[model samples]
Target: MTAVTAPEEVARIQGRVVRVLALGQVLGGVAFGATVSLGALLAADISGQESLSGFATASVTLGAALCAIPLARLAAARGRRTALTLGNLFALVGIAIVVTAAALRVFPLLLAGVVLIGAGNAGNLQSRFAATDLAAGERRGRDLGTVVWATTVGGVLGPLLLTPGEALGRLVGMPPLTGAYLFSIVAQAAALILYLVALRPDPLLLAQRISRDAAGGAAPPVDADRPLAARYAMFAVAASHVVMASVMAMTPVHLQHLAHAGHGGAAGANEAVTLLVGTTIALHVLGMYGLSPVFGWLADRWGRVAVVLLGQGVLACALLLATFGSDVQGIVIVALFLLGLGWSAATVAGAALLTESTPVDLRPRRQGIGDTLMTSSAAVGAVLAGVVLGQWGYGALALVALVLVALTTVLSPLARR
Candidate 1:
């Protein structure tokens, strides 16, 4: 097949790829968002120990970290289509297992299922990279951000489904929490089908072909700056993720406690808490994805390092607010929103930097490695956040997250040329 070189032709293909990927993101995000929102609550209920709550979210992050390299290798060998489809399949099976585990009240089974769910997240994360495969450098961040923004639709919708999901569970005789997984199952299956059917003429393969043809079958020259830039990108993404996950993992449990204390013995107390938590989570999800396009544009316009630094600053401010405002509901909401925004800034900019800095032939491997590090860091934070929250309180956990944010700031200078 002739390699596509015309700018218009490239734009056409890129547009199609972005549209398909965005749609898939929306569908897949519903499942992921629902699962994450419920993960800690489910774990706490199942284990009967507040300290073990983080394990649920941690398992998902750990699973994603473990699957990153393997999925990247698979993409390299087969194609994006196959790798993404397989990842979703893993999540589908996982949701089923999670439902069964919930029914049986088995904690270990729940953890195992969540891990596989994390594998699906690995695939979702990688899909953003696929959007950039055929994009010009100037538009790379924008295209990728558009795909990221697409997640907002389902991400927001998923948490909002909490009440309905619970009702459905009661109607069907399933555990209340397991009802959300019913939505997850359908959403994941839809995403799997979308990838298999819509992602044709895979972007990575086409980009490779174009690269080879443009170079007359010779390899592109290596840039000395790439290795350093890639390293910085990994650090920025990972640090930002750690702060977000650590705080987010414990927020539900914190809210649960408040609900018990403030509304105990009141009629519809459970429903009231569910509404509040679901809204908070939905808004958080919106903050994570809603403004990605703006961040993407800023990354391209101001440069990647600038965006990363800006994200670190935002995160620092967020942590401070959380630290002092733990008992204030409005303050906590704003802080979580800022937390999501900071994560978005760092992640979008960092990912674009990594893509531009890496050699085309080595892109998949490097991207995988970067994702592994990022998710692994978040997993550690998630696990520790539980202990910190249980022992010290949410204020202390936010302080710890603040330290990591500061470390990212210290590393920002290294990312500069």
Candidate 2:
């Protein structure tokens, strides 16, 4: 690879890289979506404590936070491919442990398994950044967004597999939620194989080589403003994620309560409740990933800061809806949708801004730091969400999320030069 400098060559490589990453994301997303859809329910069942439900999802986020630095360091030292492969392997192990734990009904084992599964999520999230590694500055957002958008396919389909997963579990003599993990295991394994085979010449390494060649084999000086901008981007992404995760983690429980109360009537009863919850989660995921390309385009055209602010506005509206319309099913659906959309916007914009602002040599580390902070914030929010929902109701949790969203909005202006 003789330092691919031609514009056409860069475009070609970027396209190829994006395609590979997108396909991998689809596979990984399916595995992640399936696991996450039932994570809380499974936790409640295994622990026999409704209050501990959020811990399942929180542990996943926590695992991601813990793995971020190590993965980033590995990417910096080895390559993105290696780091991602290792993450998937961790997830595979997690899936096995979760399956076994479910069979044995061990709560601690279940939590442990979920944490490792989160390592897989860490890899999936990092793939978006890898898409930008060889991209033209002008097209970075589009490339990144395209990869993000690819997740929509698997995300939407993952929840739909719930019934089938349960059936599969029964057929195999496994527990109810265990079937979803089986699907996850297969999906994750396929993703690992695809990445190992297809991602050649490593995008990050290639970009680094090109940079060295352009600078006559010398490294560029670090940008003084990059660190501050990165911090802003990190904060923006973290706040948005915290809001999304906090509300999303508890929505199933909320719906379950409504189901028990017969708010929607017991016409179809169990079947109706399952359909409602599954559809809501599916739509929420669609909102999270379906329109990523649009946000990406806006990020590239209108600018990253503008998009971050836009995401904050959407999030504020979502929080308000959740707070005021807590009793309405339609309102909750809309609120969750907006929550996902806001997250997509903020995440895409924040990630693009962070990538563009960071130094090449330091990009992986900064990206890791950003992800760690983002996921950890979400983890805390998730753990607290269970308590909040138990004590003050979903409305109060939304209000808390609103405050955080507002704080991000106030900080958005600082991200710009």
Candidate 3:
């Protein structure tokens, strides 16, 4: 007879797993936060074209899209430890390449490095799933949300580090915009080590083993019809992501443009612009991850479809504010914050829905595919957003993005309870 794990033992193991994953989120968030906040600015400076700035965000999302499936496959075959560590290792190398690219003034190389950083970002995305591996259905959202919330720490700190990171870089004669990434390298390396040493028993593998033991080495019964339900959840995740990416990716560029209209002052225009962008992005990121637990709880208590709709509603409000009020910095800041908050609610709820909707046997792979879809779609949205912003203006871009949120809402009928 297979020896079953005691319920208490399983709970204890899950608690430890959540704690470890939370720490990893904090570290991963910092690395990506710094890179993401500056990627567009760096690309613009290196390419000398504001129109190309959006490509930086696009590359990062594309890179994440590329890594998502492979990382999920690895987690299925090997374990979460291996997959996450590999992702962090990729980020570390990418950070170094980005610093080198900055010094060499190579736009292509910068993109290449940013893409690898995106691979690391994929690992961060997967970590939330990892948190759910041993979670009970009732607490799944809460556990996942806790890990997501942990990211608020590093994410907020990363953007705020712009000035200090820059000063440190200048002390070593590094390029103007490349200094923040120097700190990124250390953060990624630390995350790599954390996953390597701390994640014992491998949460996904352990969960699979427990399932087998419970089933006495036989396949667990699954509802043949419900696997298809994952499609709606995936769509919810993808729609929310693309909408958020389209607007958020261009905010920095928009702020930089505004700084020249007497907002940056007569002296130190670049510094003023950097600080302003940094603060705004920090707040935006704060909105993205800070209140995730609340969204997660709402997902658990309020029904998955309802919270997803709520997110779309919040997104619509944000788009309206941004569309009509792009000229006002305060309004723009508030809009960006709303943008992040909407993403948090939709993504957290949608992900939780995806978890319960799919068959256990196919969950990892399907979830990976979902992430790929989400990121790739966002990549397209971000790329197009750049064209729109470059040719027209920020307000036009927001108005265009609003249409997507409305469509997602209109299609809400597709998602079932």
Among the numbered candidates, top lDDT falls to 1
Candidate 1 vs candidate 3, TM-score winner: 1
Ten residues in sequence with the least summed lDDT for candidate 3 = 216-225
* Tens digit of per-residue lDDT, candidate 2, span 17-107: 8999999988888888877678888898889887888998898999999999899889888888998999999999998888888889999
Q: What's the distance in Å from true for residue 366, model 2?
A: 0.1
Q: What are the clashing pairs of model 1?
A: none
Cα distance off (Å), candidate 2, residue 283: 0.5
Model 1 spans > 4 angstroms off: 216-225
Q: Candidate 3: TM-score? A: 0.96
Task: State the TM-score for model 1.
Answer: 0.97
Q: What's the lDDT for residue 113 in model 3? A: 92
Candidate 3 on 173-213: residue-level lDDT in tens?
A: 99998788877888888888999999987888877777666
CA lDDT, every model vs. true structure:
0.88, 0.86, 0.87
Candidate 2 TM-score, C-alpha based: 0.96
RMSD of 2: 2.2
Candidate 3 local distance difference test against the native: 0.87
Model 2 misses residue 289 by how many Å?
A: 0.6
Per-residue lDDT of model 1, residues 1-417, tens digit only: 777766678788889999999999999879998888899999999999999999998999998999999999998878889889999988998888888888899999999999999988998888989988888888989998999999999999999998899999899899868787778888999999999999988988877777777656332333234788899899889989989988988998888777767787587777877787888889888989999999999999999999888888888888999999998877888888999999999999999999999867798999999999989888888999999999999989999888877888888777775
